[model samples]
Target: MSKMIKPWIKLIALIIALPILSYISLRVGVIPVGHTDVLALGSDASSQAMIALNDNRIPRTVVALLVGSVLGLAGLLFQLVTRNPLASPDILAVNAGASLAIVLVTLFGFSSIASFTSAALVGAFIAGVIVYLLSANGGNVMYMTLAGASLAALFSSFTQSIIAYEEGALDEVLFWLTGSVAGRSLALVTTLLPWMIVASLCVLLISKELETLSLGDQVARSLGQNVGVIKFVAVTLAVVLSAFGVALAGPIAFVGLLAPHLARYMFGTAFFARLAGSALLGSVLLLSADIFGRLVLFPREVTVGVVLAVIGGAFFIYLVSARQGVFKS
Candidate 1:
């Protein structure tokens, strides 16, 4: 089957799908809430259904959108910078770095949302810089990915070790490490929105520069775009975007890896179209996964992170195998 569509048309379809899926997500949760429950919020007396919608369901749905869109955009930027289809925050250890930072912050007993967000931004940037330097020859997909994987392993080891020894903060850290948007609050949404908005604006401002950079460093420099500054700002924005996603939902994997492929396959990689398509597709994917997690086992729910990890792992293998000609036959 062919995988091509006009960017606007595809974006329109995804825009339509997102709200429909969001409505379905609200309706198909473990509890019995539905449109009626949402409609009754204006009543003077509050009900259990309304409470669930206000407290639990709505926040998770919003967080899914927040995490998904940012991760998708970051993935696209990662690919543009690395010139590798497989480049993403997850594959490159950005999420793991942010996760380690959050764990360290938690270990110190700083429980504020501001502290968490700041730690994630700093940690993600630092980890991203290390990977960037280590993989300075980043055009080789394997070398860069391995660099990221090594860092991910090292960071995960530290995160796990801390979790093992610090039994006191285990419950909080464990739930956070699970990487689901299920328990987030509107307060968090408010706190994260500003940073996301700022980073997004920066990305938009530099999109043309980035497109030029994608042509190649020499080409970009010859065209008078400041290659170094553009690369630095672009990579920093990507890290910040990935970090915020991790802060919103701990280490949710693959939306960053998977969403870009889906977007490019659909929208043909013209920057703006790819950008919009990636964001919409990512939101739909994560939200759908969250809904599936809720209903797949009835009363018991799987985390969205686990769902994406499985999907991402399979996709990663397929990508590698295809590169090795395993799928040619």
Candidate 2:
């Protein structure tokens, strides 16, 4: 009963918070936006505030929302497939792989966001596959995490090496390498929108199979679920979603890890409800981080990625304390 009530309470809070955050995001950028700017948005393209609103703030806000939800959903899928609360796209090298791919392509003069989106998808897919292969030996969560971490480090080092060698390319990939949503336009999202929609629909379609799989392979198989196919499809879609998300906002960390856990806390562990909760909460978390970054150093903006990294660290520490069995060999 308490759990049931809790989800409802959270749902209500999120409903209230989202619009307020969107409005605040519009008003609180480096450029001043006001009631007049909002009214004259389409009528006057020449106004500085209107230009900022049309070109920058709206797109940034949309990117944050879309990236947040996609990462959250992708993280949930990874966690569900691996049965590990700590599994996330970033933690598992998916983000690093995508970043490396984006950097390499940018170095070669393919600097467009659309090109980055395609490269990121391929890179994220390859990295996800390798990490799974390395850890799929029925390894424990710690072992899988280590495997992912090692790959992430290796990929990240290679990325740094390239950046150092080609100093000029550093500027191109800096926001991407560090993970940020700044300067993103809806055009960036437009390139990947079709695929994102398909991936999301596919996830929903197989949700029942996923829920059964959550009970374990034996249970899913007993219920006539094609465990192998389901896992493959689920993982593939997850990688794709994460890839697009990274492309859009560069690897904004921790939303993937934080959102699912937060969702379960709010939605009481039902897979569908948890999924919705994760997406909603992810938007809330990312937007909150972006808002905080805007204000924390007024007139100078901190990247949303940096803000999330700090928040993710504290949350990980809390998880370690609360779930201390992670230390067990």
lDDT of each: 0.85, 0.85
Per-residue C-alpha lDDT of model 2 across residues 1-329, encoded as one tens digit per residue:
54657665677787688888888888887888997787675785688898888887888888888889889999999999988888999999999999899988988898686787889999999999899899878757887888888999999999999989998757867766777777876777787778877887888888788888999989899899999999989899889989989888887789999999988877876677787777778888898899899999999999899999999989987886899876463
User: lDDT by residue for model 1 over 1-329, one digit each (tens)?
Assistant: 33454567777888999888878877777678867776666575477777777778888999998899899889988988887777899889999999999999988989899999999988898899898889776346667888998998899899999999997876787887989998887898898898897897788778789878878999999999999888878888899999999999899899988998988888774777777777778898899889989988889999999988888899988877776742222
Q: After superposition, how far is residue 11 of candidate 1 from its true place, in Å?
A: 1.1
Give the range where candidate 2 is weakest over 10 consecutive residues by summed lDDT: 1-10
Q: Estimated TM-score per prediction? A: 0.94, 0.94
